[model samples]
Target: QGMVGGMKIPLVQRYEAGFRAGVAATNPNATVLVNYTGSFTDFALGKQVGQDLLLKNTDVLFAAAGVDGLGAIQAVKEAREAGKAVSVIGVDSDPSHLAPEAVLSAVVKHVDLVVYEAIREQRQGRFQGGNVSLGLKEGGMGLAPVRLDFPGKDEALRTVEALKARIISGELKVPTQPAPSGTAGANP
Candidate 1:
């Protein structure tokens, strides 16, 4: 895993860290490999990393490096074509449609909702300077519905939804990555 850019940048580490924490909370034995391509525009490196991870028996690859994530998606497609048991997890806007056969699901961050609420609060003269924490209960971040291409995803979705409910009800503790210090951005 490459930590190319500073982690303080909202888009750089927040989304990835959040997903990692979420996955860990659900699947404690799962191993998540993170690689930074320095810039979102670098697709080549992302592809290479994805391919390498596939070769190393990584079945699910999470692409969170913006445009670079597209390259990782391509690699997942190639691995699938080669009869490898590989799937991809997308970040930001849903990418399940990008490579339906390879995409299992996506992590969605509702940035627009946050912005709208903030704006509304300011307009109403009820703005607060302190931090505002938004999580699954607040409709801030969540996993997208599983892609139809993923086998048994319907059942998986049901299980995930149940877990989500538990987390919201405080019956289950959802792990969270520390928020980045700056304006929050959508994950992709």
Candidate 2:
């Protein structure tokens, strides 16, 4: 499916780039491990991958793996039960209620608001099917409340706020995809 406004939505690459950027900013030497379950609903596979990642010293999981994310959650629960702490950031919905202890935050897309807007526009005869990019500035997307149980929560929030400000003002631009290394226009 293509956007009506011709905006190229780079989904996976954008998310992956954002993750890499954050990791580099916070811990330059951090090792990031990524995997796919091939099926979002494959609970067994997700949990298996989750466990494997833990074995490799993964402390945080950016789980956007659909229903497979639940499997990752299960792994986090098991680890916490054994006295190991881990973090999982969710996507699609606010899953903070699922596991308060392990969920750092979730990237939530406001489906309800989007639907309402579309309907309202239709009713007003102003409906135009097109791309709508929503973010913190548009009140149509946001992170779930950060659980303050973790150390440096305040500092982390402050950093996020600063980043948000820069993004909103266009002072910082998160590339939809990372530039290939050695490209003429790539960052040196």
Candidate 3:
């Protein structure tokens, strides 16, 4: 698998780091190649990077480069059309609608829930004046449905649910920073 990012910004870093952590947990022997386009809106650069990663023989690509991500998705779709067994994972909002066949799934942020919580807190006089971090435990974010059919789909979903449960229960902690290569579960 591989990941393409827009830049080395904090938001992109978080996404890349989180993805690496997940890959390490699920497939310890898997190799995760990463690249950055250095521009969030450069679709051409994203496509070039995506094609480069595909040449490395990645089965899946995670596109977390904002608008640039769409180009990565397009690359995957074109590859699929040529009989390549490749898929993409979108970030932020669902991109499955763009290319249902090439998109495997997406990472969805529950912004509505966040807004509702903030409003409810303000109404209850419990509003905090600082940043609030929420994850699976607080229903802040999650993976969208798998749009493409693949073998072991059921098993994969089951495993994902189990891992999510562990995360929510505090049994497993996901790091916000990238782990050193060859150190799967190391924090920091």
Candidate 4:
């Protein structure tokens, strides 16, 4: 809903909100930093930005970039190789196999389900052209399998499940837009 390093997009805002929610759920004082990779296929730029962010003490780097995401994986791998503690969460399909040691998890977007639903709707005379929003509760998307090497893997799974339940039950309504300054009660 707003410009982030000239990459004005919705995904970054939503992902930041989700990360903020996680921080609130676990550590109230956690600091979350976001870096934007303007080019989707610029893996080298992604790697450079990722390494710079890691140098600044970012504990986790979530790369929602397209193919540039692979660059972030490389950055994490290099950092870990150099004996730094860091992890990354991939977007779209599961890319954990690309860097098993650095990838923590992935947000798997189910394009197939969305396509199927669209076809079904068309068949039933209910197709629409507007955007469709899918979240953890929707069969349209879910998290990929978590890597085994993550130290807090169990707690992370529990947290995700709890958040998913809250989201499904409408107890936790994630913000789709950037909130106004000075809002306190809501989690991101």
Clashes within 3 Å, all models in order: 1, 0, 0, 0
Can you write out model 3's per-residue Cα lDDT over 5-114, one digit (the tens) per residue?
99889888888888888887788777788888998898888888999999999989999998778889999999999999999999988899999999998888999999
- Candidate 3, 8: how far from true, in Å? 0.7
* lDDT (Cα, tens digit) per residue for candidate 2, span 66-183: 6667778777778877888787777778777778787788778888888898999999999998898776677787788887377887888998888778767877666656333212
User: Candidate 1 residues 1-188, lDDT tens each?
Assistant: 11122223566566656555555555655555555666677778778877877776777787877777888898998888889878887876788777888887777888988999999999999989888878889988788777555677677677778878987887766433532322121221
Clashing residue pairs for model 1? 92-187
Worst 10 residues of 4 by lDDT: 1-10
If ranked by lDDT, best first, what sequence of candidates would result? 3, 4, 1, 2
User: How many residue pairs in model 1 have overlapping backbones?
Assistant: 1
The TM-score-based order of candidates, best leading, equals: 3, 4, 2, 1
Clashing residue pairs in candidate 2 (N, C-alpha, C atoms within 3 angstroms): none
Question: What lDDT is obtained when candidate 2 is compared to the true structure?
Answer: 0.66
- Candidate 4 TM-score versus the reference: 0.85
Better TM-score candidate (1, 4): 4
Which stretches of candidate 3 lie above 4 Å from their native place? 181-188
- Better model by lDDT: candidate 1 vs candidate 4: 4
lDDT of each: 0.69, 0.66, 0.87, 0.71
* 1 or 3, greater by lDDT: 3
Looking at model 3, the pairs that clash are none
